[model samples]
Target: MPEIRNFCIIAHIDHGKSTLADRLLERTGAITEREMQEQILDDMDLERERGITIKSHAIKMDYERPNGEKVIFNLIDTPGHVDFAYEVSRALKACEGALLVVDAAQGVEAQTISTLYQAIDQDLEIVPVINKIDLPGADIEGVSQQIVDLIGCDHKDILQVSGKTGDGVDLLLEAVYELIPGPGREKDKPLKALIFDSIFNTYRGSIVYVRVMEGTLHKGEGIRFMATDKEYDAEEIGYLKLEKMKTDKLEAGEVGYVIGSVKSLQDARVGDTLTTTKNPAKEPIPGYQEVKPMVFSGIYPTDSDDFEDLRSALEKLQLNDASLSYQPETSKALGFGFRAGFLGLLHMEIVQERLDREFDIDIITTVPNVEYEVHKMEKSEVVKKIVDNPSEMPDPGKVEQVYEPYIKASIITPSEYIGPIMNLCQERRGNYINQLHMQSNRVEITYELPMAEVVFDFYDRLKSSTRGYASLDYEFLEYRKGDLVRLDILLNGDPVDALSSITHRDKAYDLGRKLCGKLKELIPQQQFEVAIQAAIGSRVIARDTIRAMRKDVTAKCYGGDISRKRKLLEKQKEGKKRMKNVGSVEVPQEAFLAVLSMDDD
Candidate 1:
């Protein structure tokens, strides 16, 4: 147990976390020269294609010190994006220490500070490491001072390493062996392992990734999940290296994978406790909080006959991604579907793409929105209801008040970009808080803004305006009362529930106008004019028209009397009116996607 060092790497996005992990693996001889690659832990093709890590990956490493002391290291690599903060939190729970990596040239940024606070809250030992020292603009001294101020550690304790060149990684590994404490061993106690993550395997059922806290788990033993109370025989037990290395048993203070006959992920939930059926633990592990999704959208099959297939695909996907939440729903225009909730827009996009590529299912996603709390008067009683879909909102006459979620956002950037960043925030209805000047020429500013405002394109705009120099991190603050209304979009004369949204009253008119204009350009022209209208209740606030396609019906009457031309034109107008009444507009998929990028106009 003393020789077992369990730790994870945490940092902001693109701060060499994965590269550092590769260097550490190479230094420890975990992977050979033939298997070396960039972002070796990010095995997903989507992750490598986008140059980002969306999931947390764990692997085991073995190393021997210069003094002939052998040690076992369990390393977990985590994502740095704010959307995956929950993943970082889950990874922290299974480790005793963390390697907080900061970019030497970029200094300390917003996500760095955000993840640092999470690590501190977990009471994990913090080891500061400055990465990317090989860069020409590397400022080791400036970044070291920033780390000292952030973690309050001595100057000599900070290690400088370049993940690209593998410099100082050996020393960093030594520090991990010396600084990070080992997990507590209780071999004699009852079996109690915490399931940090799990994935569904078609051949082996559910493969559970766990950190054993007490006793030993042997192959072919009867195990039970404490939360679900479901018992299954452990088919195989092994350590998680580059691949699953089979072992007869897993001891306490070790992290590994357990293959059981558990058929569903719900039976092996993340944060659930695992124990032997004969001698179970007295209580389950603590500090497991349920994840609350911040964004909501409806997902439907392109062909209504594939509804059942879509449900099964989502269920399989959810087995791998525990953060996704969904329930059955129906829309007037989109037909039967599920209302899905996600961590953020990026999370939603990844799930959508996975459903298409992995499951081979065609899907249509509605406009994304946030959950709202609606307090309405029902038979002289004030009842509060949670409404994620705009069409589910109660009538205006029965409403008392509506509350929207807000967030506390922190941004870190160079001093020169402060003005532009502040102006951008102000445009999003942000309330200024306070600012702090750091050691370098960087500033950290805080703001209180509605989560709805930041959900759509805020991060993209921030990156473009600051030329990718700004970093942002935000957390849910509270739900506050606001003058909010449901904005409905009508095509021809019928409302399209899939395009409806709930927004603040002040921005509704402008947003509606922009949406109508975008839809006008995206929606194709029909045989009759298609009237696109945005309305709040019965009052139409914005409108746009797509003219009908004419076939030159009066061309034969050009050499005839004026009355004949008039008669032919009248006949054409009447035919259009009849077509407009019976013909339903076929809204192209692009129209639904246009609502997502309305801010670009």
Candidate 2:
């Protein structure tokens, strides 16, 4: 029997995880020259289209050694975003070791630091790979040291490889064989498997991913998912060995897939234990942590008529991803949409793009939001506050609370922009930390800032302010008390809670003016004049308006090709359908997306 190995590649965003996977695929001759596409592991259309690794892909490669030894490699690629940390964790559980990829120029980043700790927590051996060595800003030596410092390994221990040029790629494969330990499952024991991942297929029903610990499985066998206590006959037992092709069976100390006519999602929990009736394992795999989506927002159809379609789309997505949560709620402002929770903003974007592109639905998102704790004198309450403008906050009474989540932010940039960057961070209530010099001209600065500060348009501001030379990464820390108040935007006298927002006093004016400016553009010239008021409580801080359209109808509308005139009126009605009316004034979807565009103006 061939010695089997399973490993996963992990990294921070843009650290070249997918590229490394591509080089490995190429090195093993698994992909032909024509099939030699970039970032082949990024299989999802959105993942490839956006050039972001939102989903993970895996493949098996057959390796031959000069010493006449043969081995099978199961390489799994995983998402780097903290939002998908749970998915990463599940992948990690199936592996005995990991290829921890880091951008040579960027050193360690937010999710890198976060996921590294998770790998360590899982007791998996680490094999650090410094990628992007072919790039202009490569800091191979300095980043090597950072790896040594953070991971407590020597500089010689870090492997420097460029997935782009395939430099040192052969050595990366060598390390996989030399450094990573082989699977630890003992054959005599009963069957114990951890279902790391799963997906639903139209023809196959549901397919589950599992790492076998003991015993073996075969076709027509019976098995049980521990969580659901549901048993299903193994219609097929397979290995993703060469392709997603099937095998007669997969032995213990291997990773493979199980497919049957399954339906319930509960049968395929990420951390669930799987066992067979022939023999039962005494204990399940040790490490398990349920992943929860932290950020939420309303998902609605741009056309209110497609509300049912939106519901079905969300349901279809939820069927595959059990972590996605939803609560049916009515938006007093936007009619009805599901309040959906996601792992993070990127997760929110992936869902939105899939809805807009895959399902061909026009979704109106009410802003990516977070859950908040409303503290009162008597008791504390948790609430999902979708405050876009602060004017709707009730008068302070029976309460004493001001808290917002903060994050530790790490920014890598050219040293030339450090001064302005530092000033901007200070203005946003960022607490300073030390900086490290990388290469000859690059620096990595660390800071702790409220998540709210960066949650808005700070990304754009940072890019524009730094002349696009900076990269930033952050993860949630703890909530802290600050001088915070709700900022509200009013369309006429009625407060639109969708426009109500909580912000630090220092940033309220800028955010308010910026938000109001967006509303001004989104609000077309109404039949009647409409005031766009941004305020704190009743105090209006910024004001703009959509002056009523005067003489909207030209004599041309009545006379031209009368049929063409009718077509123009129909077009006007369709345009009006795209606009969301808040009370009497019409606001377009661009208005919500443009909420942060005022900074450019």
Candidate 3:
């Protein structure tokens, strides 16, 4: 245990966390030249294609020091996006130390500060590292000072390295071995292990990734999950390398995987305690907080027959991503579906894409919204209800007050772009908190913004307005009273439950008008005119019409008398009115997607 070092890499997005990880893996001889690749820890094709890390990856490395001492380093590379902050928190809990990598050019951004605070809360030893020093714009001295102010570490204690060129990585490794202490726990104690992560395997049942906090786990041992109280035989036990390396036993402070007869991820949840059935620990590990999803949207199978298949797919996915929460729901427009909750909009998009590519399920997703607290009068007594879907909200007349979720958002950007960023925030109805000027010309601005306003295209707009120089990190603050209302979209005079959204009263009229215009463009023209109306209760706020495909009944009587043509036109008008009454408009999938991007401009 003295030679074992377990640590994770935490950083802001695109700050060279994965690149730095690759250099360390190469330096430690974990992967050979033939297998070398960029962002090697990001194995998912979606992650590579998007140049981002989604899931946290754990790997073991064997490094030999100059003094002939061998060290075992368990490195977990985590995603840098704010949407995956839960992943970072889980990774931090399993390690004894962390490498807080900051970009030399970008310095410390919003996510950097947010993740650093998480690591600090975990009481992990933080080693500051400045990455991408090879860039011509690299501000090593300025960033080093920023690190000093942020972490309170000495200026010389910070390590400077270029992840792209593999410079100064060897020294960084030395810091990990010397500065970061090894896991300190007794092996003789009763068995106690923390399941940090788990994944579902088709043939193997469930593969659980565990960090042994106490005692030892051997191959073929009878194990049990304390939370679930389910027992299974440990069929296989091994250390996590580039691949699973089978081992006879795992000692205290070791990180590895265990294959068992557990049927699904639900049986072996992440953050659950694992112990031997015979000598179970007296108590489970503390500090396990259930993930609360921030954004809610309905996911329906494009084909109704695939409903059961979609459920099974979501179960498998939940095993891997515990942050995803869902429950069965039925919609009049979309039919049977699950209203799924996600960490953010990107997380929702990724889940949808994974369902399509990995599970081959065609799904329709509704407009995303945040959970709202509705205080309504029931029989002269006020009752509070949590409503995620706008359709689930009670009648406006009975509701006394509605509170929307708010977030404390922190944005870090260069001083030059602060005006545009602030204006953008103000346009979203943000309440200014405070601002602080950090080292160099960079500034950190804080604001209290409603989560509903940030859910749609806020991140994309922020990036474009700042020219990709700004980084944003936010957390749920509290629910605040807001003059909110449910905006309903009507297709041919029928309210589509799937198209209803809870929005602030101030923005409802403008949003309704925009939604109606967008739907008019995407909804195909029918034989009869299609009226797209946005409404609140019985009052229509905005309306648009898609002209019907005309048949020109008068064309056949071109040379007829004026009265004959008028008679033909009147008959055609009656036919159109009758068709409009019976015709049910089929809203294409594109129109549902258009609702999500209505505020892009």
Local accuracy of candidate 3 as per-residue lDDT tens digits, 116-178:
999999899999999999999998999999999999999989998999999999999999998
lDDT of 2 by residue, 218-247 (tens): 777888877667888888877764357788
Q: Where is the poorest 10-residue window by lDDT in model 1?
A: 553-562
Lowest-scoring 10 consecutive residues by lDDT in candidate 3?
592-601
Candidates in order have lDDT scores of 0.90, 0.75, 0.90
Spell out the clash pairs found in candidate 3.
none
lDDT of 1 by residue, 364-439 (tens): 8887889999999999999999998999888777889999999999999888999988998998889999999988
Better structure of 2 and 3 per TM-score: 3
In the order shown, what is each candidate's alpha-carbon RMSD? Answer: 2.1, 7.3, 2.2
Sequence-dependent TM-score of model 2: 0.82
| Estimated TM-score for each candidate | 0.95, 0.82, 0.94
lDDT of 3 at 313: 97
Regions more than 4 Å wrong, model 2: 29-36, 102-110, 130-162, 165-167, 228-230, 277-283, 376-403, 414-416, 433-444, 467-469, 482-484, 517-522, 527-529, 535-583, 596-601
Error of 1 at 465 (Å): 1.5
Model 3: runs farther than 4 Å from truth?
303-312, 558-561
What C-alpha lDDT, on a 0 to 100 scale, does residue 112 get in candidate 2? 77
